[model samples]
Target chain A: MLSPGIMGRSLLDKVWDLHTVRELPSGQTQLFIGLHLIHEVTSPQAFAALRDAGGAAAGPPGHHAGGAAAGPLGHKAGLRVRRPDRTFATVDHIIPTDSQARPLGDALAEEMLQHLERNCAEHGIAFFGPGSGKQGIVHVIGPELGLTQPGMTIACGDSHTSTHGAFGAVAFGIGTSQVRDVLATQCLAMARPRVRRIDVAGKLSPGVYAKDVILAIIRRLGVKGGIGYAYEYGGPVIDAMTLEERMTVCNMSIEGGARCGYINPDEATFAYLRGREFAPQGEAFERAVQWWRGIASDPDAVYDDRIELDGARLAPTVTFGITPGQSVGVDEPIPSPADVPADERAGIEEALAFMALEPGKPITGTPIDVAFIGSCTNGRISDLREAARVAQLGTVAPGVRTFVVPGSQEVQRQAEAEGLPAVFRAAGFDWREPGCSMCLAMNPDKLRGRELCASTSNRNFKGRQGSPTGRTLLMSPAMVAAAAIRGHVVDVREEL
Target chain B: MSSEAKVERVEGRGCVLRGDDIDTDRIIPARFLRCVTFDGIGAHAFEDDRLQAKGNHALDDPRFAGASILLVGRNFGCGSSREHAPQALWRFGFQAFVGESFAEIFFGNCVAMGLPCVTLPRAELTRLMDSVDLDPQQRLVLDLASGTITSKLGTQAIAMPDGARRQLLEGAWDATAVLLAGGDAIDATADSLPYVRGFAA
Candidate 1:
C-alpha cells in the first residue's frame, strides 16, 4: 500500500495522469478513454464519420480521407476503430419513457432510434435497445451495471455524463466529433482542465438531500463559475452521502460549466461497486478495491481553487428562472435586481421577466402546471422513494400534471418491487418506464403552452421541458412531489 | 487522416445578441434533436425564444435576418454538450462568432465544426455590438490568421488561445482524422492497456 507524503495531488490529477496514453506534438494529451457511452442523439454522426473514412475515395466531401486541409496546419481524418468492448450505447434521448409500443408516434424520433439500432448492430458495439430491460438512461445503466468505476476516464456525448465522476473517475461530456474520435480511436485529444475543490462540511439538516446540496452549490457558483475547471466535491456532507446521492451531485457538473466533477473513492464506493455484474469477481474484486482506494487524493492534495459551504445552511432549493444558477431556497424570495450583484442583475431581471415572476415574491407557492420527477439528476431509486414517501401522504392537487420517471429499467424494477409505483399512481402521478423523460422533452413526456413546471431535472433553461414559454422550477424529487400535491412550488421539508 | 476544412477568415454581415451566458438550449432547443443529421435546425435556431417573444427575439429581428456573423456578449453557448448548437448556427450561415467570452465545451464544439469562436476586450466587444446592432448591413471581418475582428469598429485584437487559434487555422480539429492518423501508435496503446484484452474490457 502506498503512503501519503507531504505533497498530495487532487483526485482529478491522479486520474488524469494515469489515463494519459501520450502527449501529442501539440502538447495535448491523448487520454486513453476507458469507456465511451453514447445515445441515439450523438452516435449517428460519429458512426457516419467512421463509414465516411472507410470509403474516403468514394464518399461525401465531409468524408474526405484527409479532411479538407485548407488551413496552415493539416488535420487527421481516417478512422480505424477496432475496439468494440470499450464502447457502449443505449436509446434514451428520443424514446418514450412510458411505453414500448413499436411504430412510435414521432416518425423522426423513431428513425433516429432505428438508425442507432442499425449502427450499433453494424459496429458490434453493445447496445441496450428498447427490449433489453437493461435499457435506461445511459448514466443510470452505467453505474448500476458496474461499468462506471474508479480510476477510469469515461467520456460520453451527453453533457450529464459527468455523473460517472462520483466514482472517482475523470468522466466528462464530449462533443460528437470527440465521440467519433474516441470511437475511431479509444483516445480523446485534450488539454487538461484545472481542479476546483468544493468542500461542504457538516451533516445536512433533515429533508436536505444531495440534490438540494448540489443545487445550492450551482446556485452559489453560477452557471459559468466552473467554465475552465474540474470540480472535486468533498468534506463531511459528500462523504456521508450514499452512492446514488453522490451521482446526483456530480450529474450537474456540466450545468455549472465545469468539464467534469468527481469524488475520491472510499469504502462506500467500493461497497457500491462490489458484486455488480461488470465488477471484477472474487479475489479480483478485492484487488480492484485496493486499486480504487489507492487512487484517492492524498490527505494534503493541492487544488487550483477551494470553496467552502456549510451543508446545514442549505435549504430545499429551486430555480426561479431560466438558468440553473438562478435559484433560491424554497422559502426564499425571487431575488430583486438590487439584491443580486450588478453584473448578474440583467440576467436576474431577464429571468424574472421570462418567468412572469415578480421581484420579492416568495419562490414558494409559485403555481406549477406540471410536476416532473426525472432526468439523470434525480431519477434514481432513492429519489423515487423520497418522492413516493410524499405521494403516499396524499393525492396530487387537481389539474396539475405530474410524472415520475425512473432513471433506468433496473431502477423502475426496484421501485416496483417496493411498490413505489402504486404509491405514485395512487397519488395521481404517472409512473413511467425508465428513460430521460421530461428532462429534455426528447420524448412524448413534455410541458405544453405557457405551463409552468416544478421539475426534478437538472436544467431550467428556457423551454427545457418542451413548451417554448413553459417555465421550469428545478428542485429535488420530494420537492417536485410536494409541488404536485400542492399544485405549486413548496418546500418538501415542511411536508416531511 | 487529414482535413481540408479551414477558417482563415470569415467575412459576412454582422448581427448583435446582447446577452451573456446564452446556452445551447437557447441556441437550439432539445425538441429539434430528433434528426439523424443537423439539417433544418438552422431554421429553428432560437426557435423557443423567437416564439416566446412573438418573433421579437434578436435572431428574429428583420434587421439581422441575413446577418451571418454573430456578435455576442460574454459566456455565449454555456450549457449542454450538444454540437448541434454550433451545427445549427453553421446551417444558419454563421461563419464565426466574436464574443466577450465562450464556454469551454461550446468553444470546442464550434472549433470541431470549423466555426471560430473568438473573444475580445469588453470595450471592443461593446463597440462591435453597438456598431452591428445599429447597422446590420455592416460587413464584419474575422481574421483568424491575425486574431482580429474588423468592422466599422476597426480591427480589435480578438483573444483566442494560441492552441485554439492553431486548431482553427490549421484545420486540426477533425479528431477522428487526427486519431486515425496516429494509426499504429493508437493500436499499440490499446494493446498495452491491462484491461483492454478480449474479456478484460
Candidate 2:
C-alpha cells in the first residue's frame, strides 16, 4: 500500500497503486485493467487463441455466461472473458468508411468482422457495429462515450489508446497477446515507468495548435527519449488547453516513445465528462470529481526527470522525415545531414532520400499530390471546425486530391449539424464518414504511386499512407486545409 | 501455447539491421495485416523494405539465412503496438533480440510470446553487429540467468528488466493463468475502486 501523504506523489504513482491487483512473482505488477477496448484488426487472433486454450472442457465456441450451461457442446466452451462488463468492442482499423453495406466488400475484412461480432456476442460484450453511430477509432469513441474516465487504467489494441490519458487516467496501448491476457484475466503484467514532468511554459502562438505543440515536443525529445518514462504534461500552456486539445496532445505520446501520457484532471476534464452517456450521474459525478482531483500530482511531487519548453516560441511545425521526431518549423530549413552528428547522418540521409527532400531547403512551398485531415490525432469536432474555417478561405487547388475524414460518427454528426461538411465539400475536400480512413491506409482509401501528401494524421513513416514510395508531411488540420487550397505546404498563419 | 514454455537461453546466428527507429510499418506493412490470423506473416516481414532493397536487406540476405538472433540499433520496433510485428519476426525464425533499445510495447509483446529482448550500450551493440556481419555464421548466446550475451569473440553484459528476466527463466511468460489465479484480489480491488462501483462515496 502507498501513503499519498508521506511523500508528494505524481498522478501516475497514485493511479497505479489504486489499480495494483497484486505483484506477480516475476517482479512485475499485475495491474487491473479498468476498461479493455478491442477492434477488428487485433481481436480475432486473440479470441482464437482463447478458443484454442479453452478446449473442449471449456465447452463449445460461443458458449458464454448462462449459455455455457445450455449449449449442446456442454457447459464450458471456455468463453473466458473475465468481466465482460468492463470490456467494449468496435470495428475500426479495417472497416471502410466509404460504405455501410452489410458483409463488407472485402471478404477477408468481412470474416474478421464476423469473428469479432461472434466473439462479442458469445462473451456478452458490447460491439459498436457499423451504422451503430458509435463505431469509430477506438481512442476517439472511448472518451466521447465517457467510457474513459479519471483514475482508471485503460488498454486498447490500438496504439493511440494514450488518447484516453487526457482525462487524467493511466492509459496505454497493448498487443493482442496482452489483449488476450486482459480478456482471460482482466489484468496485465507491467513494470512501473519513471515519471517525467514536461512543462510547456508560456502560451502558443496564434497559428500553432495542439498538434504542433506535440510535434514540437517530439522533435525536441527524440523518438526514443521517453522509452522508460511516462510523461506528465503540465504548466501554464497545458492548463489552458481544452479537453479535445489535450486529447490531441496525448494521442501522439506513443510517437514520442512514451507508452503513457497524462494531464492532471481539472474543471475542463470534469465538464467534458459531466453528461456523457456512461459517466457517473448526479451526486455520483460530483463525488467522482473529488476523487479525480485528489489523484492529480501533489504540489510538492517529486519526478524522476523534468523538462521545460517555451511554448510561445514554437511555430507551426511539420515532420519532414520518417519519424515524428524528425521535424522542423514551417519557416526553418531542413537540417543538413552534414550538420548533425555522424551517427545520425545515416538516418537523416535515409529520410531525405526517401522523402526526396534536399537538405537546407525550407519545407514551405513543397508541392503535394494529396491532403488528408483526419486520424485519431486531429479528427475531433474542434479539428474539423479549425480545418473548416480554413476551408472557407479558398477552394482546394486543381489536381490536389483532398479528403476530410471525421474521427467518429458523433464528430461527423456534429460537423454535419454545424455545416462543416458542406464547407469542406464546397472547398473540393471529399468529406467522408467516420473511420481511421487514410491514417494507416488499411482500407480502400490509399495514395497512388510516388505521391506526396500533406496529412493531419500521425506518422510520416515510409509507405505509411499506403504507397510504398509515397511521402507524408504531418501537420495540424488547418495546415492540411491550407495545403489543399494552395497545392503545397504553406503556413496556416499566412492563409488565415 | 502452453504455460510450460520458457526462454532462458537463445543461442543462434545473428542478423544485423543497423538503423534507429525502425518502425513496425516497415517490419510488416499494413497491407499484410488484413489477414484473420498471423499465419504466414513471416514471409511478409519487412515486405516493402525488402522489395525496395531488392533482397539486399538483412532479413532478405542469404548469408544470414535461418538466423534466430536479431541485432538492431536504437529504438527498434518503434511504431504501432500491433503484435503482428513481433509475430512476424517470431514466425520468420527470430527467437531473441539484442538492441541499443526497444519500444516498450514491442518489447512487451515479444516477452508475452516468450521471446527474450535484451539491450546493450550503443557501442557494445555496434561491436556485436560488426563482428556478426564479418562472419555471418557466428553464433551468439543470450542467457537470461547470467544477464549476458556471449559469442566466440567475447561476451558483453546485456540489460533487461529483472522481472522480464525472471519471467523468461521461470516459464511464466504466459501471464493469463497466473493473473487469473488472483481472482479474489482482482475483485476486491475492483470493488474498492469508486468508478466501478459508480462512485459511491
Candidate 3:
C-alpha cells in the first residue's frame, strides 16, 4: 500500500490542479467551475442577490486587461452570467408533474419559475422550461444531455449536484450565495476535502441495487462520517455498474454527509457519453476518452482513509428513520434503543417516535399508504423499467396510492415509446410528468397526514415528502413497486 | 464588498439547541422555500420543530427568543444545501455559531453569508451549551482573530479551517468579489483544459 502524502496523486488532485484559477489570500483555492446547473427553487434568491449587489459577469471589470476576447468583461451595468455558454437552467423543484400549465396552481411556484425564465433570458443562458423536451431534474438532464462530462467541476444551488460526480467530475452542491458567486465570477472559493476510497467488492445479491449499496455504506459510515471528505467509490461492483446505476449511487452522496462522491471514468462511462446531445463528435470523442482515461486515479494513489464492504452480503435496504444512515435490511428489525449505546440511543428513539415505528419489530410488513417511484436518485428509464417489471406481477394493493414519475422529459419520452407507462398504469400506479415530483415535495405531490410512503427518492428526512408528519422510507424503485403491490414494506426479492 | 464588512467579533446572548445531525429540513422545511425571496423567513426558522414542541422548543421558549448566538451539537446542519436554513437562522437573529461540527455544505453556506461557524470539542460544546442554558441571558463573545469563544463562565478555544478563519476575519467571506478578481487566471485555466472546448482544442 502507498503511504499517505506519497508521490501518487488521486483523480481529485489532478482535476483540482487543472481547474485552479489561483490560490486566494484566504488559503482557499479560487477554482474555475466548468459547468453550472440551476433550478427554480434555489436560484431566485441567488439571482436576487447578484442583482442587488450590482455585480457584473467575471468581476468588477479591469481584472483582466487582455484576457480571452470572448470573456464577459466590463459589463458593470448589471449582473450577467459570466459563462452563459456553460450555464443551464431548468424548473424542477416547484413544478407540478400533474400539469405543466402556466399560471401554475401554486402562485409562488409560478412566480419562482417566471423569475428563472427571466433570469435565463436576460443573461443569455439556456432555459429548458416546460415543453422544451429537455426539462427535468437539473441532475437528471445534465447527464442525459451529456453536459456532465468527466474532469469537469459542476455546481448547482441544489444539494444533489453531487449526482454529476458519477462521470468523474469534481462536482459539489453549493449554497445560494455560492451560486451567486459562480454566476458572477465563474469560480468558487473553496477549501478542498480529503478523499476517502470506499471499495465494495463482490457481486450484489439478487434484488439488491445501487440504492442498496449506498444505503449500506451510509448505514455503516453514519450520516456525518463523510464530512470533510470526498468519497471515491471503486472495486469490481462499481466497475460493472451502468452509468445510470453509478448515478444512483452518487446522487445520494449528500445523504451520507459527503458533499461530493465520484467513480473513475471507465469504458462504460465513455460508451454512455458517446453520441449524446452535448458530447463530442466522432474523432473528438475518441480524444475525449483518451483524456478522460488519463484523469482516473493512479493505481498507487494515496487516500486519507479507506473502507471496504462486500457487495454480495448486502441485502435490500430501507430507511426507517429520519436520516438515511438509520436504515436496516428489509427483513431486519428496527433497532431498539436498548441495543444502541447511550449516546446513540437518543437519535434512534427520536427517529422511531417521529416515524411512529415500533422498536425491535421487523421493518417488513410495515404498512404503507403511498408508494413513490421517482427522484434524481432513481427516476431514469432503467429504474422505471425495473419497477415496471415488478409492476407486471400484481395490481397495487387497495387504498394504496402509487406514483411512478420519470426523471426527465427524455426519460419520460423513452419510457412512453417503450410502453412502460401503460404497464405502470395497468398495475394501478399513477404515471406522472417529469420534475422532482414528491422528492422534496415542493410541488403538488405530497404525503397526507401521518401517511407512510415507500419512496425511491434520496433523503428520508422528516417532512421531506411535504407533510410535517409524513413518513418516508427510502428504497429502490423495484422495492417500491413490490411495496405498492403489497401495501407494506416487503422485500422485492420475495415478490420476484 | 468592503474590509469593514468583515466579521471579526460576535458578542451576544446564546441559545442552545441540543441534538446531533439536526438537519436543514428541521431548521426550515421545504414548504417555506417557495418564496422568490428570503424575506420574512425568520418567522419560520425551526417552524415545524417549534410547532411540534408547542412553545417548549428552544426557538419558541421565551428565554431564548431574542438570542443572537447559537450553540448546537455535532453535525448541526446535516442535510440539504438550501441556503434557506441558514438564511432563516440569520434572519431569526443568529450571528455566530459554536458547535461540535457542521455539515460541509451548511458550513460553506454560513461562511458565504458572512456568518462565522466555529467548532469546539464535544465536551467543550456540551459545557458551553449547558452554560448558556443555565444562564440564558449571559452574553458570549467570539473573536475570530483570537479563535476563542468567551463568556462569564470562562473562555475556550474554538477551531475552524485557517482559510475560513482568514476569510471571516478579513471580511472576504462573501467570495464573489475575491473570485472575480481572478478573471484572467480563470480564463487561462479554462482555455488549458481540453474538455472545456469539447476536446477539439
Candidate 4:
C-alpha cells in the first residue's frame, strides 16, 4: 500500500469524487445518487412525504416512462424529484416467503406491499412485484440484474445496501428522510466517512465461509468500532472470494457499525456482471468492464486505518449473543461475562439470559428448534450449494423446523436448476421461495415462543426472528444446515 | 444554508434511561414495522419487552411518561437502520436527549428529525441521570445556540459535532430543504446519467 502521503487513490475515493456534485455550506457534500433501490418497508412513507411536500415524482429530466407525464424536474415544486430510471423498487422485507398468493394473510404486510406497488406505478418507476419473476430482496436482485455497478453511488433504505459496494460502488443505507431526499432530488447531503482498510489475508479454511469471515471481523472490531468510517475489505482472502461471496462480506458492514464496506473491482467483478440483464452489451460491455477494472485501488493506495486478520485460522463461527459482535467459533465455548470486556459484560449477561444459555457451555450442542438459511447475506446460489452439500449428508433433526428460503426468484430458479431444493426437501427442510423470510420475519415464516434458531440471516437481536421471546444465533448457511441435522448449533467443518 | 427557523432552546422534564448499547430492537421491535405510516409507533416502542417485563422497561415507566427530554447511557440506539426508532421516540414525546454517546445512525436520524442528541462526559452523564432519577419532575432546558443543558441541579455544556450542532441549532436538519435548494443542479445531473433516460428513448 502507498505511504500515508502518496497520491494513489482507492476505488472508494474515485467513486466518491465522481459523485460529488457540490459541497454545501453545511460541510456535507451534495452527492449525486446514481441508483436508489427501494423496498416495501421504507418507500411508502418517503413517497407519502414527497406527495405531502406538494411535489410529484419526475421522470428523467426530459423523458417519461410508461407514457406517464413528467412532473416539474428536481425539487422545483417545493418537493419535486427527477430521474425515475434511477429508482427501482422490489417487494421484499414484508412479502410472504411461502407463496406468491395475493393479499397476504398479514394485513399490515399486504398494505406495505400495496403501497410500494402503487408508489412505484405512480412515480413511473420499475416495480418488481411478486410473481414478476424479478421480485426479491432488493440487495439480492440489484446485483442479480446487474443494476449494481462499479464507480456508482447507490443508496437503499435498508442497512444491507452496503452489499452493493462489493462492485466497488460507494453505497449506503439511508434513513427514511434521506430516502425522501434521493427520491426528490436524486442526491444526498452527507459528510464523507474516513476509510478503514481491513485486511483479512491467508486463504479461508474449508467450511469457514464468507459469513465466518465477516462475523470474525465484526467480532474483532466491536459493533460500534466502525463508527464514522467506511470499511475497505482487501487482502488475499477478499481477492479470492467470488462476487457473491464478496457480497456476503459487504452485506453486514452495517452490523459492524460501518455504513458501507467495499471491495475493489477486478476481473472477478466484471466477469460476474458480464452479459447480465442490465449490464452493458457488446462493445458497450467491454468499455464498461475497462472502467470497472480501472476503479480498483492502486497497489500503493492509502487508508485512514488498517487492520490485519488471518482467515485460514478461523473456524465455522456462530453468534452466542444478541449483537453480531458476540460471535465465536463453533468449536469454542460460549464466553463468560468475565472473559469479555467490562463494557460488554452487561450485553453478554442479557444475551445469555435472553438466549437461555449459560456462559461456559459450548455452543456446539446448543439445541435449536429451527434452522433458517436465507437473507440478503447468504441466500444466493453458492450459499445454497454449500448448505445443500451438508443437507445431502444428513437429515433434518426430528421436530426441528427447517426452512431454506431463497434470496430471490432468480436464486430460487438457479437453486432448483441445480437440484438443490430437492436435496433440501429430501433432508426434511422446507424449501421455500424468495424474500427476506425469517431473517426479519415480517412474513409468515417466524419463530414461535422462546424457540432457539440457527439462522444464516444477520442480526440476532431479541425478537429479530419474529417472536419476542424467541432466540436467534447467527451463523453460516452451512452451519445452519448442520444445525438442522443435529437439532442444535454445530460445526459445519466436520459435517461438510 | 437553510431557510428553517433557528432553534435556540428547549425546556422540559427529564426522563432517565440507564443502559449502554440499548439498541433499536429495544427502541422499536420489528413486529411493529408494518405500518404504511409511522403512526402510533410510540405505544409499541419497547413493545414485547415492555409486555414481558410487566411494564418495567424505560419507555413504559410512568416516571418517563410524557417527558420530552431523555437522558440515556452510552451507545443508545445501536442496531438497525430503521428510522422508526426515532419516529417512535418522537411519537413518544421525546424532543431531545443527553447521552454519553450514540450510535452513528441513530444520532444522524435524530438530528435529521430535529431531535438533538448531545454527549456529556461519563461523570457528568451520571450526574445528569442521577438528578433526573432523583426527581422525575426535575425540569431541564437545552439551549441549542449556547450548547448548554441546564437542569435545576446544575448546568453543563454538551459536546456535539459542529456539523450536527449547526443543523440542530438552525433547524436546518430538514433534508428536504437542501434537496430542493439544489433542484436545478440535481436535474442537470440526472440528465447526464446514461441510465436515466426517458422511456421514449
Candidate 5:
C-alpha cells in the first residue's frame, strides 16, 4: 500500500507514486509511464513484435483470447496496451526541413516517412507529418504545442526527450521495444533513478548561452557523471532563465549521463504555457497552475547528491575533442597530450590526430568548413534571433558553408516574419526549414571528409555529423554565427 | 534439444586501439541504423570517414583488413543509445572491445547482446595497439572465464563490473535470465501482495 505522504501529492511525487507498480529486488522502483512518443527510426521492430503477437492471438478462440493473450502480455498484466489517445507520432528525421513536398529525395527515407504516416493512421494515433505546420522535431513540437506539460511522464524513442523535463515533467528516452510496449500499453515498467540537483548560482556571461553552460557541466562532471540519476537543475541561474533557456539546458541532460534533467515549474513556466495550443484554459488553466505550483520542491527537499557551480564563471565554451565532455573554454588552449591525465592521454592523442589539431594550440584560429545553427538544442526562434544579431553585423566568410535550420515550421514562420532569414541569407547562410538537420546527419545535411564544423547542436562525438572523420566543434548559436562569418573558430564574446 | 548446442566462438589476440570519446555513430552510422536485424552491419561499421581518407576509400587500404579486436580511446560508444553499434560490431566478427571507458547505454547494450566490453588504463591500450601494429599475428587470449584479456607481449585484467560476464559466457541476450533469477522472490511477493490495477478502460 502507498502512504498518503507519498501519494496524491506534488506533480513529481504524484506521477512517481502512481507509477510505482512494484519494487524490484534490486531496490529499483518499477514505475509505470503515462505516455510514449515514437518516431520512424526506432519503431520498426517493436511494431513487428506487436503485430506478431496480435496475429498469434487471433488464431484459436479460447487459446488465443485467454491464456495465450496473457502470454503475450508478459508476466505483468498491467503492462498491456491500453490507451492510444495518450500515444502520438511525429516524423522529424529524414524529412528535409527545407521542403515538405512528397517523394523525398531519398526513396528509402520517403518509404519510411510514408510507412509511419500509414501506421499512425491505421492505429488511429495522432501523427504530426511534414505538411503539418505543427510538425517539427518531436522534442521541439511537444512543448511548443503544450502537448507536454507539468506532472506528465513522457517517453520518446529519441534520447533528448528529456527536454520535456523543462516543464516539470518526468521525461526520458527509451528503445524501440520500450516504445512498442508504451504504444500497446500506456504504461512502461521502468526502474526509478536517483535524483541529483545541479544547482547553478550567480549570473551568466553575455556571450555564454545555455549551450555553453551545459557543455561546461558535461566537462566538469565527465560524460558518465549522471549515470542512473535524474538531474534537477535549480538555484539562481536556472531560476533567472526563460523557459526556452531552461529547455536548452535540460535538452542535453543525457549527454552528461543523466536519464533526465528538469526545472521546477514557476511563473515563467506557467506564463509560457498560458495560451498555448493544448494547455488548459480558463478555470482549468488556473487549476493546472495551482497543481503545478504545488509540485515545486519543498523548501527542504533533499537530493541524493548535489553539485553547485558559479554560472557567471562559465565562458563561451567549445568542444575540443570528440565527446561533449572533452571541451575547453573559448579562451583556453587545446590540451596537450602531456597535460592530460595518464588515463586520458590516449584520447587526447587520438582526438588530435583525428581532428588534425596540434596540442597546446589556440582553438580560436582553427578553421571551419561549415557552421550549423539548428537542432532541438538551439534551433528555437530565440536562438535564431541571437544568431541573426551576429549575422546582421557581418557577412559569412568565403568558402564557408553555413546553414540556419529552425526547430519547427512555426519558428520558421516567426523568424521569417521577423526577417531573421533575410539577415542570415544576406550573410551567406542557407536558411533552411525546421527539422533535426545535420544534428546526427539523418537527413541530406552532412559534412564532407575531414571537414570541421562549428555547430550549435549537442554532441561532438567523432563522426556524429555523418562523415566518420568529420570533426564537430560544439558551441553556442552566436559562436557558430561568429565562426560562420570568420570561417574559423572565433570567440563570440570578442564580437559582443 | 541437445545439451551441447552449437555455439560458435571466435578468438584472437586482442588489439587495443585507444582514443577518447568514440560515439555510437562512429561505431555504426545512422544510415545503417534502420535495419531490423543485425545482419551484415559489421562490414559497414565505421563506414564513414574512418575507413576512408580524403578523396580515397578506406576499404581499399589493407591496413585495417581482418582487424578483429578494436581498441578504442576513452568514453567509447558515447553518443546515441543505439544498440545497432554492438550489433554491427558483432556482425563484423569483433569478439571483444577493449576501451579505456564506455558510455553507459552503449556499455549496457554490449552486455545485453553478449559482447565483451573490457575497460583498461589508457597506457595499456596504447601499448597493446602498438604491439598489434608491430605484429598482427600476436596472440591475445580473451579468457571469458576470468574476465581477463591477455596479449603475448603483456597481460591486463579487465573488469565487467555488473556480472555481465556470466551473460556473455552463457550467450543469452534476452532479459529472461534476469527475470528467472528473481522469479522466486517475485512469485512470493505477488502471492502476498494484492493486485491493484490503475489504468482507465
Candidate 6:
C-alpha cells in the first residue's frame, strides 16, 4: 500500500529501486549484482561444481556403467562458472607479506594460492597476485583503482566488502556458495533492508579521525543495533571527510550490526574519481557524474529510522572486550560486569575472563606483548602515515614485537617513496609488504600463546589471532603505534 | 495437483555447544571454504582448532556425528558474513540453530537457504548445553511444525519473527513467494502504481 511518490528517497532507496529485478511474494527483492569479487579462500568449490555439472551433461553412454568408473565420484555440479568477466580474483588471506618468492612457506597457503591462480587462468578471470602492482587487499584495490564507483552493487567473499560503500555503492559480503552463484549468474536474490539514517552533525575535534567516529558510533549502538538495516551516514562531518576516510568508517559498518553503510555521492566523491585508472574518460565521466548526482538522497529524504550524533563529543576509542561494541573512550575506564546490560552480562564476564582484565580498570596502561597495525579495516597509506608519524617520534619498547603492514603493493611503494618505511624501521618496527598480514593469521604473522597484542584489525574473537589463548586489544592504528612505543595500551592523544 | 509430494525429513539428535562469538572461520576456516560441493565439508567443519587439538578428532567425534540441531550461546556466528558457516552446518546435518542470538548476515543467509535459526533465553541455552555436556547421548528434538525445541531433559517453545516463520513454513525464498502469497492483489497493486514503470528498465 506504499505510494511510489514518497517525496524524498534516500540513496539506498534510489539504488534499491533501480537494481531490483522484481518484487516477489515474500516481500524481498531479487537484486542483480553489478560487480562480484572473489578470492582464493572461497571460490574453488563453486568452479568445481560447475565443471561437474558440465561433465555430467557431456558423459558417454558407459561412463557411469562400471563400479570402478563410478567409485565414489566426489563431484556434483549446481554452480555455473561461465561468467568469469563478471568475477575477479585476488590473493590476500593466505599470501605472506614478508616474501615475494614463488613457493609460499606454508604448504596449505601455497596450495590455495596456486589453486586460485590456475582457476582464474583456466576461466579467463582477471587475478591480482602478489607480484601484480595492482595487488592489495581486495577492498583497497577496488576503490584506489576506480573499479568501485557510485550506484553499483558490489559483493565479495570477504566481510569488509562493505568498504566499497564509501564510493556511493551498495556493497555487501557474501559466502562461498553465494560467491559461486554470482560467478555463474552475476545476480543474487536478496531481501531489501530497511534504511536507517545516522546523522553526525558538527565538526570533529583535532587529532580525531574516522576510526574514532566509527568506534564511538559502535560504542553507542550495541554491536547488534543495526540488524536488518542499511545505514546512511550523513551531515557535516561525513560530508567533510575525504573518500579514504569515509571508506574507513563504512568498512566497519558490519561491526556495528548494519548490513552495509554508505554516504551519498558528492563533489568529494566526483573529485576522488576524476583521475583514477578505471574511471570513465572525459565526456563519459561528466555524464556518469550527472547520473551519480541524481542518485544522492534529496534534502528531505525519508528513512525508516534515524539517529543523530554529535561529532564534536567523540574521542579516540578502543575496545576493551572481544566485540567491537564493547568499547570506551581512550581516557575512560573499562566497564565492570555490573555496569553491563543484563542480556550482555555473561558475554562481558566471559570476555573479562579470556582477556584477564579487571573491571573498572583503565585499558590505557594495560601491557601488550605485540602491536599489529594492519588489516583491510585500517591498513591504508593514511593509516600508515599516521602510525609512522608516531613511530618517527619515539622508538618501540624493548621486547615488544611491532609490525607495520601496508594494505597493498601500491601502498607499500608509496610509503617507501615517502620514507615511511624508514621511519618505521628506525622506530624498531618491521615494515612489511601487503596481503592481509597478521589480520586473520592465515600467514606467518600470528600471535603466540597468551601473548597480548594491540591490534588495528576488526575482530578480536578468542583464537582469532592464531593462538587459542592469544589476547587482542582492538584500537586505532595510532593507538597501536603508541602501544608499540610503550609496550602498553597508551592513549595516543596524550602522547600527541 | 494433489498435495502428495514426498517430503524429505532432515532428522537427527541435536548436540549442544555453548560459546560466544563463534566466527565463520571457526565454523569452517577460510582454507576449507573453497570447494563447490557441500559434500565432505561436514567432515572438515571446525578443522582448524578441532583437528589440531591433542586427543581430539572433530570429524570422528561421535557426539556431533548426526546432530541436526545446534544449541549455542550468545552471538553465535559473529565474525565474517561467510555463507560457508551455515553451508557447513547444513552439510554437517544441522537443520536448525538454537542460540541466544545470531549475527545479522548469518541469520539472513540461514533463512534464505531454509536453515531454521531460533533465538531463546540465554538461561535456556545455558541449561541445554549443560545437560548435553553431562550426557553426550542426550537427544534434542526441533519441531518446526510446532515451533518448539524439546529434549529429554526439558522443552522450550520458541517464537520466530512472523515473516521468517511464514517463509520457512511455506518453503519459499526470495520475493516470488511474497508476490504469490498476495496473488491477484499484487497484480492489482502493480497495475495501479505508476512509478513501477520507471523501475522496469
Rank order (by lDDT, best first): 3, 2, 4, 1, 6, 5
Candidate 3 vs. truth: CA RMSD? 2.4
* TM-score of chain A by itself in each prediction: 0.94, 0.95, 0.96, 0.95, 0.92, 0.93
Give the winner by DockQ: 2 or 4: 2
List DockQ for all candidates: 0.50, 0.63, 0.71, 0.45, 0.20, 0.20
In model 2, which residue pairs have backbone atoms overlapping below 3 Å?
Answer: A58-A76, A58-A77, A58-A78, A59-A76, A59-A77, A60-A77
- Fold similarity of candidate 3's chain A to the true chain A, as a TM-score: 0.96
lDDT of 3 by residue, A1-496 (tens): 7675677878899999999999999999999999999999888888776666643333445554212232355544445667889999998899998989889999989999889999888778999999798999899999999999999999999889999999999998998999998987788999888999999999998799999999999999998999989999999899989999999999888888897999999999999998899999989999999999999999988899999999999999999999999999988899999988787888999999999999989999999999999899999999999999999999999999988899999999999999999999999999999999998888999999899999999988888898989999999999999999999999899889
The model with the greatest DockQ is: 3
Question: Mind giving the per-residue lDDT tens digits that candidate 5 earns over A316-432?
Answer: 999888778889998999999899677667777877787888877889989999999999899898999999999987999999988899998888899989999889988889999
Which of the two candidates, 1 or 2, achieves a greater lDDT against the reference? 2
Q: Any runs in candidate 1 off by more than 4 Å, and if so which?
A: A1-6, A55-80, B191-193, B197-201
True contacts kept of 5: 0.21
Per-residue error for B165 in candidate 3, Å, reads 0.8
Badly placed stretches (over 4 Å) of model 4 are A1-6, A55-80, B1-3, B187-201
Off by over 4 Å in 2: A1-5, A55-75
The sequence of per-residue lDDT tens digits that candidate 2 reaches over residues A384-495 is: 9999999999999999988798888899899989999889988888998788888998888899899999999999999888998999999999999999999999988998
Interface RMSD of each: 3.9, 3.2, 2.3, 4.8, 6.6, 8.8
Can you write out model 6's per-residue Cα lDDT over A215-275, one digit (the tens) per residue?
8888788777776788899999999999888998999899887888999999999999987
With candidate 1 superimposed using the best TM-score fit, by how many Å does residue A3's alpha carbon deviate from the native? Answer: 12
Residue B156, candidate 5: how far off, in angstroms? 9.9
Task: Show model 3 residue runs off by greater than 4 Å.
Answer: A1-6, A55-76, B1-3
- For all candidates in order, the CA lDDT equals 0.83, 0.89, 0.89, 0.83, 0.73, 0.75
CAPRI class assigned to model 2: medium
Q: Residue A260 of model 2: what lDDT? A: 95
True contacts kept of each: 0.57, 0.76, 0.88, 0.47, 0.21, 0.19
